[model samples]
Target chain A: MATARAADEAPAPAAPAFDVKNAFRNICGFCHEDYGRKQGKGPQLMDNPNSDDYLFNRIRNGKPGRMAAFGGAFTDDQIREIVVFIRKLKPNENP
Target chain B: MKRHSRKAITTASVAVLAGLAFGAQANEGILKRSANDWPSYHGDYKSWHYSDLNQINAGNVGKLTEAWSHVASRATRGLQGFPLAVDGVLYYSSPYNQVYALDGATGQMLWTYKQKLNEDLVAKQTHSPYNRGIAVGFGNVYMGTLDGKLVAIDAKTGKLNWETKLVNSEKLTVGFTGAPLLVKDKIIIGSQGGEWPWRGPIFGVDAKSGKEAWKFFVVGGNEGTASDRRDTWGGDSWKTGGGGGWMPGSYDADTDTVWWGTGNPAPLYDWAGDEWMTKGPRPGINLYTSSVILLNPDTGELKGYHQVLPHDAWDYDPASGELMLIEQGGKKYVVHPTKAGFVFVFDRTGKPVNVYKGVDNINFVQDIKPDGTLVGRRDMKEGKHGNLCPAIAGGYSWNSGAYSPKTGLLYKVGFEWCMDLEVVKTTPILEPMAQLNIGANFTFQPPKDGPARGHIRARDPVSGKVKWEMKFKVPPHGGLMATGGNLLFIPEADGWFSAVDAATGKVLWRHNNGQGHNGGTITYMAKGKQYVATVTGFGSLVGDAYGELWGEPWVSMPKDAGVLKVFALK
Candidate 1:
């Protein structure tokens, strides 16, 4: 009975971690092209991933106050990319 | 006092400033409106966002590179400031009310005055984290703090001359957003946060002593309307009313009358709750929420006014723009551009003369009737969710629109792209960024559409016509300005600051500044050399969406993250 149960159980791989660079390139729309500034809309997410949740909440919300909201505007997966991108720019990792 | 000579009132970031012609003494503000010295917001209150030096005009502006960039450090200070230059010194109020004086030619820090802040300093700044900036008057520069204090410092030495607690928000608290307005020995300033049961008033403070000279409250705005508010607000419209004068006002020294526009009634969306100030004799007009209200600059007495948005339900604030008075055809007409999309022209008598819709993609006001009665749009309904045009941020938000006296046109960059908006009723009490209150603000969803997706248009003041417009990759990132030459500088939501032919509306040149812009553009002559400057700190409501929508319109320049970039052609 144990051998039969083991045969019935198939394995599933875990979800991958959000890639900071890929997320950034995805948003920046420029892969391997580091345009330090000049990227409009929202400035570079560089090192901002470590910001407190509320600031990120406000930033991701689209509208800060009386502006507009983006709760449903972006996918959660994409947002995870934003979080990862901010993390990748850790000074220790880069230098 | 000829028209062209008055053009020398130089400044950066136009703030609905105004002026009047005086004797030909060349005594405008302290200096000739140089192309480098941003003497006052809107130059010198003549509200001419125009500069005198044509050094960086259409011809050679191509060589206009970022001459100097003061990128802010996250821990040191944020760049939520408008740099005010007097002669060769540049003064700016940075994050935490830290004042920095920089050299005009080079963005070199000369002196720094950091206002010590405790942990509680973060609490007072719920509205805007940073001060709009400081004001330069006489020989001193003035600034207000987040912890509730206004300090005056020697403009040259950066030494504290006097520090006064104007309104201790610690009790009955409110924030300061209206940049200080200095008129002679007095400075006129008002506070924001009118929505929060906070008492709103515009005061005349002694410029030197920091003593309060006069205070004007909006609850009882019109002295002539009798003491019994019940008579003025026939229905229960006067109670819990929230008309506040939040921005710096304009003045006519000759007439001794200072004019300011007040904001919308409180519990913003609930007209019924705040009916005491809304319903009755002053009912629709509401005794000046959206009007050009005049008072004796010294007395603070109600002189005269004309309502622009009677019961501004659409959240279309006429109070956002400064009462910029423009003179043409020997007639003194005040051109007060409203966030609601109308550039309402009124004679000095406070009578509406003509109203023009500066933007076409607006659904805020129904129509500016022949009699100046805003019928309001017919399809505009309450308690529903749908796409609203021109957004509550407005067709032309708080960004200052400059007028080129040389061309007789109001050079403006209007935020035309709209949002799908839904209004709901709410209580007066609102938490900072909560999920509870939905009344005062409408739900907006920015649309996918034409080049007019948040655009910038040039208009004729007298005719109320769109001369030519440059659609932004997204909404206009900032405000606009015109110079002595045929040049109009406008910013795009995607981070491109474009210079257009002020005459033909042609895109003369465009350059990227790394991020989208929301700050206004200003010009001045520094060391006899003219320079044009603007601030970019995108990522607010408009920024996040447009950046997401248009992909990318600018290249990232972290060195200038939310900085003041001054440009001059080589």
Candidate 2:
């Protein structure tokens, strides 16, 4: 649950932390795994860190009817870290 | 590994363990028989449609033509329930609870078992529809009615052996939609009420005497705990929870256990009651819904459990596809493809070693833990709707999936799609009350970009990696089979039959079967030659919303599209 924020308190800024292989794993379950559509227990992700609104709300609030929530277990800054990582995710020439 | 990427790799050992425990053999195409036999619905309980016959390889498949086709008497309003082939005799069930016995060699009807559908009984049922298929064991054929009655017929003669009513269709509107899976002497079946407020369960009946053997519920109610899911809603959705084992279960003879997945929780659209599902993983992993549940064939004991969809609010039921068993490098495993667009590999212990997201365009959760437990985002946990990755129907739906031992690859088919689903509560409920099922207008939404089409690919089940990939303009559906001739037989929804190179994932040959396929494809050796068969008819969730999502062309009229096309190698 999002608590009422004070004027002094604001959402944390994004962190520079990122998994080095972010892009290669952007569509981690891509290609042959599900013939591409078999997303398994989890849905696919984007490489574009700019896909954050779609990412945070998806990861923080959780997309209903499809995904569940995780904001409580994870800190807003930690989530932003993931969003940053996703934005830079790009497939290398070969994994 | 990617930070948020869910690992879909399960070591071969885990798959074998899950396979042994569930009594389902490796789906590596080992337990596969000649395509002609169609011995088991999934060809010998293992659910692997792999055939040894190489006559119809890519080399000769181009010359292949449809030898014969048997169209259904009436257009199928919603045809699900696959057929059973034994000793060249094909036994199939049609909508309205009708069963037909056919000759596998020639698409000829040898006998027909019209269930004398009790319209009055069905009318009273929440969603009285028809039979899925039947099981043949102990010299008798077992079939369940849309109204929840289990009937046993003699194998040789179309005579009724015994009948047992499993559920009162009026009170539950729950019945069997999956073909009866025969394990040793027991005929295992499940009921359908996913769309309704009926209890979820898989029922086992004595194959010989038609006696009630055991019943394993997907949702818990008997324990009498409000915290227990079955008591949550305290209403029909709570009571019904739609545990229909809509898809046939896979049995591993070695394990003596049955591996089956459960359907979606009821109340169709609104999953307010299925709270846990809205959260990370629903409580109890919904017992059986979207879970790989193990049942003791003899006692029907629920030995172990693993959930594929926790608190399934999106209707991404794991009940559709088949459970394939594979053994890699001496490690055995249970291979399963879910409607949620996942190609999951689990250890024999039912532990999630790895889970990989295959869909390129889903937007639900970010990842899965090493234990196979799902980690949901905080916001999406509660029953609400938005840009859920898979539109409940998931990356893949009620079609078949396959594996080729020769290449050690798994093949899954489907349209990569998602939607903006908003679960609004329905008032007064729709009639005839739809057999106490849940109701949801699963609105169709395409991916952020690209055409709304599907594809089929050959995958490395072990690493959750892709070996080769191919695309289809129309959404793809059905199971796939790889053969000795280095070919993959794929039935498509684009009215074409195809053969792809087993190793490279190349589309080597194609045939216009004339219609899209719904069920999986199977191959066998008949008359010293190899022949392939696929069931082309729509059923399950698609039939429920055929008109809305599929539109007019792919639409289903009360009875419009139903046919079984059998092809042979010259």
Candidate 3:
């Protein structure tokens, strides 16, 4: 098997521009469902009554037994972007 | 034609008989398990998931009552592990790597062992904490931890024998959630992959002393090795091709081969359409993933394989189903169900013998031929596609089906649902920590045939001839078990555990365990008394959708609770 590259051997590349839309599709949409417009595995996010701080913290430090923490995987700014995306979610006209 | 020649023939026959008996014993209680023990993950090497204990038969199944129950602590996503019984002791695992040894008849806790884990790493994982099952042999109980270690606990006394760190889960963010199969002297376990951007590796570890033996990369096979099929992927796409044998497979003692299934490739949905061979994110056939792999357990060598879905863009993994070893008309066939809702039958050599549909709504491909070719392929470009059949949750989930030799039938549960998908082009997340590489957003919807529902069907393993079926409002997330008592035990998602006639599909007995079932059901004999034990809880990755889809008990069900409920005749 190919060995995992050592951190020192390969310099870290620049972080790409965060695409919350595509990011939701790739990760959060699995449980959020319908781009957060509808409830599925998790509650619907489009009209969620929770505050933005609550959403950001929930995304960063996930609730135990319910969701996984993304603090390590995503930057704080990216998590805030996710909160904004959740706030902007609306029902798809086509759907 | 002399009297002396005839005497030599009789002596040779005796020697052959003795050889057969020794071979059975040499397998070390796996091939020929005792009536009281459920030693291996699939109950035996055949993956029968059936017990021969008939002390509680269909006639007296109505008198079955709960003997005792043991509640597991910190059952985050519930107790998903199957219990193993040997010599009146029941060994089971719950979430957070907690193992308990109980008296099979009394449910009295003898001892418990809790492994110290990297809690921070586990908290960051998507499929965290829940242990599926364990293996028991060589005076030890083997379990795979969520933090990427395989530990052996002494079976008689709950003490750590040894622990081996196999995967670099801190970097890759994926580890072992499935049980290890005790093949001879090696503990073979597969890592969780598919959606993660990593070459999922299945390891063969020394069972006696927790030492790393061999590893087989299911993604692009071992790097630079000929016949590893690394050429199946384009460029460096194989580096994160995402293939794993996340579930435990069975052993075929006749051929001395392990028949395991592999998960699908990363970036589950392809956006290249028909130009997949050259233009896709990870082009070529992506060999070995979504396939039935025949392996040499001792060396982790790929013996032969049949890719069930070539270029599987639907996340239809063959790894979810148990490879049921069935013999029909003198031909031994491995019957496997892919997540795409079709069943493939193969010979001992990994050659496809037959293909049949297990569920009704399957439009991912128009048809999968008996030769394992996908016809009328539905390759989606980067756009919205309507009503893709057999939704993201799959026509079949990771739970296993049961096959019974008594009734000559295979009992399986299948879901009927479709999805509205919008395929997106996403970049692989491989730096610092790996994340899910799903390339599509989808929502569950009812199939054209009817509402979204599930059914348990008893069918011929080779022919797919349905004998009978019982439909449910919601699918059962747990595994099924059949018995020689002519009863099929099904733990439903609505907290009901029922015993139905294996031949008739009639519910003979039912009991509510207060939560949805999402783990395993098993039967074993303890002190000459037959007992049925099942793990009950809720909140699996797929099962988490139950609240919105069917909103009654599930909306109010507890997710962090689990119990091992054992029953016997009153």
- On TM-score, the candidate that comes out on top is 3
Better of 1 and 2 by TM-score: 1
Residue lDDT tens for model 3, B1-570: 001111111233223322211122325677777777787778888898998888888899999999999999999888788998876788899998999999998998899999898888888888877999998766677898888889877665677777888888899888888998988878899989899887888889887667898888998787656547767777677888899889999889888999888989988999888777766677778877888888898898888888888878999998889998899899999999778999899989999989999999999899989878889999999989999999988998889899999999999999998989888887787666988888887888999988899999999999999999999989898999999899999999999999999999999999999899999998887778889999999988888888777888888888899999999999
Model 3 lDDT, full chain set: 0.84
DockQ of each: 0.03, 0.02, 0.31
Clashes of 2: 82
Query: Fraction of reference contacts reproduced per prediction?
Result: 0.03, 0.00, 0.46
lDDT of model 1 at position B60: 75
TM-score of predicted chain B, candidate 2 = 0.84
Instruction: Give one digit per residue, the lDDT tens place, for model 2 in B122-223.
Output: 443323353456665555566787667787665555656567888766455456656878776577887775665456678887765677888777765334
DockQ of 1: 0.03
| Model 3 chain B weakest lDDT span, ten residues long | B1-10
Q: What overall lDDT, based on C-alpha atoms, would model 2 receive against the true structure?
A: 0.58
Q: Which sequence of candidate numbers ranks them by lDDT, best first?
A: 3, 2, 1
- Per-residue alpha-carbon lDDT of candidate 1 for residues B117-190, written as tens digits (9 for 90 to 100): 53343442334445666777645677766655667765555667676676655543354655777766577777
Deviation from native of the Cα of residue B408 in model 2, angstroms: 0.8
- Most DockQ-accurate candidate: 3
